[model samples]
Target chain A: MKPAPFAYAKARSVEDAIALLAQHGEGAKLLAGGQSLIATLNMRLSAPRILIDLNGIAGLNSITLKGGEVEIGAMTRHAEIERSDVIRKHAPLIAMAMPHIAHPAIRNRGTIGGSIAFADPAAELPACLLALGGLVEIAGPKGKRTVKADDYFKGLYETAIGACDMLTGIRLPAAPAASRYGFAELSRRHGDYAVAGLAASATFASGKLTKVRLAFFGVDLTPVRAKAAEMALAGGDLDKAVAALASDLDPPDDIQENGAVKKHLAGVLLRRVVQQLTETRA
Target chain B: MNEMCDISLTVNGERVSERVEARKSLVDFLRDDLTLTGSHVGCEHGVCGACTVRVNGEIVRGCLMLAVQCDGASVETIEGVSDSGEIADLQEAFQKRNALQCGFCTPGMLLTAQDLLSNDQTPSRDHIREHISGNYCRCTGYHAIVDAVESVAQARKGSRK
Candidate 1:
């Protein structure tokens, strides 16, 4: 299990990586964590001529909390996010979603930016980011620009990140004190990709639900927010929101599940999560 | 055809530098170049944890990473950690618990179990199962392996107090 022959360069900075990408274009692939890239390379699925290794770039893995937002460097490992008290405090949604990522070993090497760039429909990170209305920072030839999570993920194995660009970091607005989060996924195995999953956050002022956001995975080309359900849940009537999911999500039919089955699981998860959110903290 | 990359790393507390093929995985580098054959390459796709090893104190899939990417990194394979007697009690517990039947999965299992012990000397049984979920052991049905790791964790916790 070796990759196809390719020249490797340890990128010193974002400028260096961007220059190499601009030089090689599609022939170059940025290697971060290498969890997905190397496996794809070894399987002969993709053969980029040059790999711009991003591991050498310093400060790409910093986790910063400022301006009531959590900005995580794109190269930060999943384990770091899982263990970061900053994430657990400021954005509990991300902290809640980390364990649902692959196992601890994979978490040790897999980067959140790589997962976001990969845009796996079944993965949990994208959906969590979507649920939290997070943003991604991309450094391209022009300069750095932030894209909302909603506009970031284009489709399966796709994102707004360009061939000559690199995802530098992720920005998550601080969750409010009144906000409560819930995440659940049903997979055949614990570490396996979920069959159907949902992540959600809802804010309550006094006893009235003011805002609710839900994102479902393994149901569409990208992690899709159930906008209809979110609107319906604003009134705190979970049954109405659960019913609205049927219209908000149009699930894909795969060998493991039909569209109807995924929709059903989505509703089941919505019910469980809504109950968890409304209940007292554990 | 090959493109060689120069990389330096500390493996088993020893500084090593070499020119390796850019495509060569860290597992192959450990096994073929340095002859540290303890880390096996199974399911080389990162699904199976047979190639699990410590890179800069974190367990990672050796097969999923290229040796060239590990420049100036510290890698500790089963050979180094085992030789240091760091996980001897866990190993003995595995032996007493019969965690392996065929022994092909033992190296990865031991390393994975040691990873859990190092992190939390008192991890829950479910935590043990969750941590090693990626390390597939098709032979033992996982009961014995969990038993071995859990026994070691409890024993170690008991001794610490």
Candidate 2:
């Protein structure tokens, strides 16, 4: 497999990248880690007129704690997030789910922004962001704007990022005191895309679960928040929570598995995650 | 906009300058232009680990990267590292254990194995398997491969002692 002939431009800054995007409009594709983009190019699934390489743009690869959130630059690689003590302390779900993203080699070059912007239904980062109540920062010709994680993801491979916009960074709220994190996924292989997965965050308060958020991926067009299941769990009805998944998620049949099978797996994951989170307290 | 660009990067240890198509993959550049065929081309879509290599000190899928994107970067392939004797111990261990049968996936397997050993000297069997899970070995079924890597890790620890 080989990519079609295309021109390449390396942007020196985010503004430069935006300018390049503005110039090319929909004809150009922004290259972050190139892990997924390059593959699409090689398969000729995508043939952009020009590739605007964002790797040369500085300041998009830093991980910092600002105010009450952990700010991760869009160009930040997955491996960096896996080892970052700040993430491990502040956004542990992202850290905990890092190894499942891919193998060591792929993680070395794949960027957090790429994963989020690509918006793969089976991806871990987007689901983690949703569970953590994170935010995505997008930059366009009119300047920068922030989109809530709840509003950022639209559909399969579709995001709030417009043709002339670029995702600059993502900010995850600092973990609350006594908050517990639970993350697990099932795949044919460890690094393959998940058959079904769950990322949940909840605060254990006085023998009761409060502010519980369960984000399930590989079970919908986008990472879905299981509010019904969360409500059931918060009300102390574990059986109801599991049963509520039928109303919460309606996964479509994919090449890997059937929709009914995916719904069943999602229920299984909810139980396991709840058990794991509660077990940590004892 | 030019479809071809000039790039000057270090391959192995020597600096090389050339003009390549922007669409050309780094693995193809190495195998065709530099004659460093140690890194084989399997599935070009980043699934198969047949084209694993090092760029700027970290391992990446060679096919997932474009040669033009590696401008000014330092790259290392199996041939380069093998010639430098960096993975000599791993090579010997693989030979002794018969970890490779077809040898098509050996280059990527060795690079991935060395990557794990260099990072953690005492990786568990499960951890080793997880780390190299991306590299598909169709023949060995991975039992012998894991054995070889584990033995080398123990030997390196012994040498240190």
Candidate 3:
């Protein structure tokens, strides 16, 4: 019930935070929202010699929609994203998936970059970002770099973010005018981690789908991009996409669900999301 | 050994300053240091909402947040919200509907339900249930709790009319 003790430092600026990270390396952990980090700390699953609290940095919590893209800072809370009209207007797919992350209390403190940086296989933000074709910005002792969503996530609880790097911002190309999205997940309880989840976004132009992207979470080592399904569903009906998932995915059994059941739920969610895209025509 | 931090904040409208360990949870700080025992500790990992409280006008899991993070922030616990008479009607509604059995989860439940009603003037039954999904109520089956919330909403609406 108690976390191992660690020294705490607050970063008033990005450079200061990165300096601390470089100094401590893997021995230090950045406290973003603390929704996920503190939980691991309390359970003794993670112990670090230093905690770099990023909340004191003033500019990292802004969400900007400009130049045909949406840029969300790393410290932006889930609750802020859920209620931001700018997010809803620019990237509705991410907005659609916000409530599924956790309840409002948790959302008020949990952060978007933290979720992506943690890279939980069961999380919704990672899959949603994958479906949005998002990019992650990283800052470290070597300075700044940008990684595409496809390259950002590495594996279970692992990311391209270096131990001495801090995820600074998430960037997404603006959803096209005709882009319609559907996000759904199967969890025993509403706010619990999903047993299986799906997020799909596509442009419906001239009664046909274009730029189709489907991402599934809680069914693999990382959020999976169903490219085969996307290819099959482009300019065609959703049943093809739903059926293609069977071939595209083969997740192993986990504590909450057997592999077969998870596959079934994933298929079910795909159908619902595709139906959603159809019912809510662009 | 843990590093100690000194933090100052307004709790229930009172400005208080204290020196706490860097690793001390907000819930433990309030309960042990300040003797504000209204908020309970159930699952310290932020799943269960038993330690819910308002920090800078938003409800958060107190157990998941460290006291040092709350420096200069405003926190409102169940004890504060109850004493402020802000949720008098909600407390009465809970009693009328028998929303609790053992009462261990009552305080957190009230604060959670209060948050829902404050944000929504008219939330559906499904919405109420959805909002409190994080708060675990081991007794009362949640039917009475939902009813109490629904009842308060209706009363507020009637009074508005």
* Maximum-DockQ candidate: 2
DockQ for each model: 0.65, 0.92, 0.70
Clashing pairs in 3: none
Fraction of native contacts, model 3: 0.74
Ranking by lDDT: 2, 3, 1
Per-candidate TM-scores read 0.96, 0.99, 0.97
Cα deviation at B11, candidate 1, in Å, is: 2.0
How well is each residue in A1-282 modelled by candidate 1, as lDDT tens digits? 567799888789999989989988998999998888888998989999989988888998988899989999999999999989999899898888898888888898999888888888999999998988899999999999999988988878889998799999999989788898889998877878888999888886676666688989999989999988888888667889999987898998976789998999999999888876777765
Model 2: per-residue lDDT, tens digit, A1-282? 899999999999999999999998888999999988999999899999999999998888889988999999999999998989999998889988999998899999999999999999999999999998899999999999999998988888999999999999999999877888999999999898999999999988777788899999999999999999999999999899999999999999998899999999998999899987777544
Clashes of 3: 0
Give the clashing pairs for model 2: none
lDDT for A108 (candidate 3): 93
lDDT of 3 by residue, A1-282 (tens): 978998899988989999988888888999999998999999999998889999999988889998999999999999999989989999899888988888899999999989999999999999989998899999988899999998988888889998788999999988877888989999999999999999888887677777888999999999999888899878485677778888888888999999999988888998888888767543
* Per-residue accuracy of model 1 over B13-104 as CA lDDT, tens digit each: 99999999999999999999999998988888989899999999888999899998888999999999889999899889888988988877
TM-score of chain B taken alone, every candidate: 0.96, 0.98, 0.97
Candidates by DockQ, descending order: 2, 3, 1
